[model samples]
Target: MKLYKTYEDLPKIKLPKGQEVSISDSTLRDGAQMPGIVLKVDHKVKIYEYLHNIGIEKLETFVYNDRDRNAISMMLDRGYEFPEVTGWARAATSDIDLVLDIGAIEETGILMSVSDVHIFDKMGLPSREAAEEKYLDALQYAVDHGLRTRAHIEDMTRADNTNFVYPMIKKILEIDPKCTIRLCDTIGFGIPFVDVEEPFGIPEMVRHVKEELKAVNIETHCHDDFGLAVANSIAGYWHGANWSNVTFLGIGERAGNAELEKLLLFLERRIEGFDKYDLKSLFEFAKFMEREIGIRIPRNKSIVGNNVFAHESGIHTAGVIKNPFTYEPYPPEVVGGKRAFLIGDSSGIEVLRFKVEDTLHDLLDVKISVEKNDPRLRAIQADIQNLYNNEKRVSCISDEEIQAYVEKYFLFEPIVEKSMGRKTL
Candidate 1:
């Protein structure tokens, strides 16, 4: 699809061509940097395998300690070619040596704080020229050691692109023509609109990098402080950047980064050649993150959330019972999620009928044609409504309660046998 259709007259975001978009995960590195989170080697390995199975192209990790090195070694030994294990380091020769000591990683992201805020306030550098020299020297050292480099311009959203950003990237390309430029929207000041100027506009920044600086490979690494990480990342791709740096659940420092599952779903639906990813694995991976890593998935979170496909309101359930498209944006099965008719205070008789049918089919493997106006269905609905109307219930009716009601009112063996020739309910 060239454009995601919303309305014929409304402006649509045009999809960029001539460059295929690829996803690079930072779950093992940046994601682990979230406060109060520590991923052991086993957790890292399992997360790596999960990312590989979900078709991630690359994953960046730290190599500062033996635990990090051992995780890299185990993942590399698996011989998977897609998610090439890469390294992350500060723009220092000592950090470069840490990556080199691993002796297996071929590429590493060299962090260069481009903004004056980071260069001066964070690193306490004397001048922008000194910061540029230090970053360039480190890039040279990495290239000299036969390691492909990704120049991670930290805090690019707040940097001066004309004098500092462009000149430094130009020199980085001069040092290694094949170097990848990763525009880090550190602290998430990036805006997706192209009309906005630099220091805020992600599209303008990406365009300058691709069109002006002539960088061959560009990656967009965004944060979610403004809740625009995915939007800014997509904006970068639409403008020209080919690589999207993401984490599994957008887990990173502060507000986290662009979510891998959210971006994958967007690319799968909006762009071509992204259908190769196993979208079903998204729900499984979210569950794994929640179960193993103790990261709670919000019930209302998009794509893999529990309530994304659930219908509880009376009008919604009624419409969904007729046609699920009336309430759902996409099929629940598309992401390994199931359609649920949750019984609650606002639910209607349609939900009761659906629950009865589903329970019967699942438990007894029998189907009985029941009319929508059947008294048995109404009675079951009344029983549920009574819990709220008279009993002052505050929680949603559970499936076990619905099953009991269905069994009590509708599970007549004679009626079931007469309808479907089944001897059991």
Candidate 2:
């Protein structure tokens, strides 16, 4: 193994130039809205430092109240600078003032609901023109206040970009070319695949905004209603999205937001020069979130999942025993996770040998050598199989069972003369 002094000295392992996307963490805001997930003011300080040191470019904080405002202030006073902190707010000057007065955030994200459902059904506005005017008024107020703004078009996937969204973009650009607009998939209504049109397909919508809508500095914000948040985010990235809005573990309202870990893992693989993201801290972050938020991580969650690196199937264990890459896309250590193997009813003989030779040799300081057709190995395997099949056992045999069996069998001296045609050991 070797270390590189500079990024130039390292191997090129990114998607490509000009396709790099920035990350804006939404854990403290939208993620906090998760039903049972809650974080106090003190937690924000550590979380902020954690995100900053890991090179996360931005963190979304809440400017709606004093608790969040004071927390943001304390976090800033800690002098962590990498993650330029931003606050989530409505598209209004008062909210922006509330955040800016704390002297913490230089930028803020404002919600601009674009879907007809929000425009008519929710806001009770006369028409799209009325709703557009309402958001424009708020945008104008934000722009006049000299605060950098991220106009999040909420429920974007459920709206007609041509009729409703395009006009808003034109108005926004006229208001100020510096304002960054976020395309929000409010209900996880986005589809990742191509050969599709607007009303939820992200690829076509992303391209449309860039080419036709002439929107500048587009951001991608997706939900996990259909379990396509990560996929939708990647699609937006490939289609010229400049930013990916994410949460720590995809924890948010309803389904959730795109997972920061999943997005970074994919970006690390496909996008060149996208290596600045601290991948190793991800596992710790996941664990910390689980402990602090009181939500257990699902065993099969991607990248940071408990069982993402756990192998148990006989065939999978055998392949992984030879090479981890045979059964995994990336090494468990890459994410600071340990590779684990579980022996069960589907266990094979090679797995048994691997378990004993690889694990027991170091612990017991005893070597148990057995051939492929060894009668002792067959007897042990028969017992294991009988436990599951013949004896009606529901669970797999434990390591203690195998260990006791092996210890007893090894104690028996091999000496045969009359039982077989040849002497056997």
Candidate 3:
């Protein structure tokens, strides 16, 4: 079935000269916060190392407890070269103290509410001014402690950028010129579509910060409630923001975050000269997390899902067999995946021919040359159709069943010779 729309159809976007976009994998902090996700200390360490090995620019973890603290410490001791370790915490001195005690992270994200609802309703601050003061004080403390800070603006899309967010960011730059300001769509409300306006307008959002707030690196942290987390992050890049905050498999609060693999895949394609990251290890990392976190990889999940490279329909399978790129955006091998031509009720003779000539021969150690129009191919195809229509099999023919068909036709047995004499159907 057709999806609602695709990013492919959108007009090509090109960023200005000297622009840079990098991705930070947040599988430790945001992804770990998902309900029912409980990572052991070793799980955290493994995840951090995996993200580092895959060339993620940064790793964000929350040292909320002993397990997390120990994990962070261990990951640091390993001395990963690519992903500089980062910590996630509220805009409080206590959180900063904990991060300092963890002793290995180079940076930390200090949560500061920028939206009216978050400042007043969530954090219970009397006014935006008071909220900014409190957050700035904590940020200053972190910078004074020699920690690079990412001023995480919660609900940035819903926040007052002109008066509250922009002005506060200027003050943060004064305290720490190297600090990163992460614009967060905490509730998945941001959508970076064409002709969008403020709140969901990513280009406007980035320009609002860059134009007036002084020089600072920008990161996009979006949720998937609207199912546009990845799109919003890409928009952030197109506009001005450089860093993208993503989680593995898009696992996080409620609808989840932008998928790390999905974001990287797009960056490799859309952004020129951005293919340095080692993408092959990403699939292994996804599988490792799926095993450790006890979450099922949805069959249809983007990039790493089972069905992402599995073909079944007649036209799709035939086209894919001819050239994988015919019916696909890119080869499955691009991300360490294999292509599978799934024979089913809708499979065509072209699919059957490929399966017999390639797959079955390899699987059963049988040599056969079944052309697309071979009479034996038609006979076996009729048998498969009969199995589907008459027997009402819930699934398509199995490898064993296909082998049987091949054996019956080519390596004919004496027992079933009478059935063949009835008529060639």
Candidate 4:
């Protein structure tokens, strides 16, 4: 192995850089907003601690609804740590009162529908002026009450940029210049390059808001309506937005928020100095989510999939065996995962030898001769292979069957020949 102090040949980015990228996990808040998804109090604490452990310090637990708010407080009082245990709320004093009742206003976020459709149609408000006044009032109210404020500008993509979007941002910054502003692509309308042109895409929107408002920090809350949530989030980071709201497995309202597992994996690889993210623990935490929360990770999902490191083709397997970096972007060991070889028609003789030698190295006392092309060996191999291939189907085979047929015949065949006292033929 060799080490280098400089990365002279590393790839360079062409886009103008933005702010420091920070992850804000919403596995509890916005994720719970997900239909049919709920975490018990204890489970929420575990997840909260887990996210913090993996270098995600900011956490959003839930909206200001009564049942959920009580649960969040219980978890918070139980000593959940991170940036803070914050609850989400509508941009109304009544909603802020709900957060105060739960003892969370000082550690809360206020979410308002800032887009034209939400302001006009959803809230039945006449115009952006009315919504701006309401938002400013609620933000100032929270601030006056000694609360650290965060505002969600929901559905920024569909909002009327000139009329509703710009003015809303202006008012919020006027109230709290350091207030964390979330540019939500609610309904997932912000695509990276295809649906939107450069310097005006989702990333551009975040950048524009940050610069226009001169807000201390900006956050991105993207949806996957157009399958560009992850791309948009990265672009947001590149363009100076630091914070992002993400959910595990990308689970949320429609398609989902950015998948936390995939999101962290992307950052660990693409962003410099991201080794701070506990890559291995993140995957383990993801597995725990699947086991405890009952949400299974998709097989083709990035980072932690069973097949993410599995190989079967001769060329690929050989390259992986020689050096995992040959075929894999990053070593599986870094993520507490191991590379796997699935032997089938594509396997070459070397792979078979490697597997056989590894398995039989200490168990077998004598060397065994097996031919790659020999018909007899192939038949026995095929027969053995069925046992593995039909593992899912042959559950009906009983212990009695193994004892009466398999153990007796298979184990005794070779010994029987030796004991028969048969001389050389």
Best-matching candidate per lDDT: 1
Using TM-score as the yardstick, the better of models 3 and 4 is 3
Q: Write the per-residue lDDT of candidate 1 for residues 165-191, one digit (tens) a residue.
A: 888898899899889999999999999
Stretches of candidate 4 off by over 4 Å are: 1-18, 63-83, 102-105, 194-200, 362-425
Off by over 4 Å in 3: 1-13, 363-367, 414-425
TM-scores for every candidate against the unseen true structure = 0.92, 0.87, 0.90, 0.81
Which residue pairs clash within candidate 3? Answer: none
Question: TM-score of model 2 relative to the true fold?
Answer: 0.87
Candidate 4, pairs of clashing residues: 18-240, 19-240, 29-61, 250-259
lDDT by residue for model 3 (176-219), tens = 88788889999988878656676767777887777667556988
RMSD of each: 4.8, 5.0, 5.2, 5.4
- In model 2, which runs have C-alpha deviations exceeding 4 angstroms? 1-17, 366-370, 373-379, 390-406, 411-425
Q: Which candidate number has the best TM-score?
A: 1
Ten-residue region with minimum lDDT total, candidate 4: 394-403
In order, the Cα lDDT scores of the candidates are 0.88, 0.79, 0.81, 0.70
lDDT (10s digit) by residue, model 2, range 73-176 = 88888786678888777756677678668665778788888898898898777898877887888877777777678889999989988777977887887887
Which 10 consecutive positions of candidate 1 have the poorest summed lDDT? 4-13
Task: Give the lDDT of residue 39 in candidate 4.
Answer: 77
Q: Which stretches of candidate 1 lie over 4 Å from their true place?
A: 1-14, 362-364, 411-425
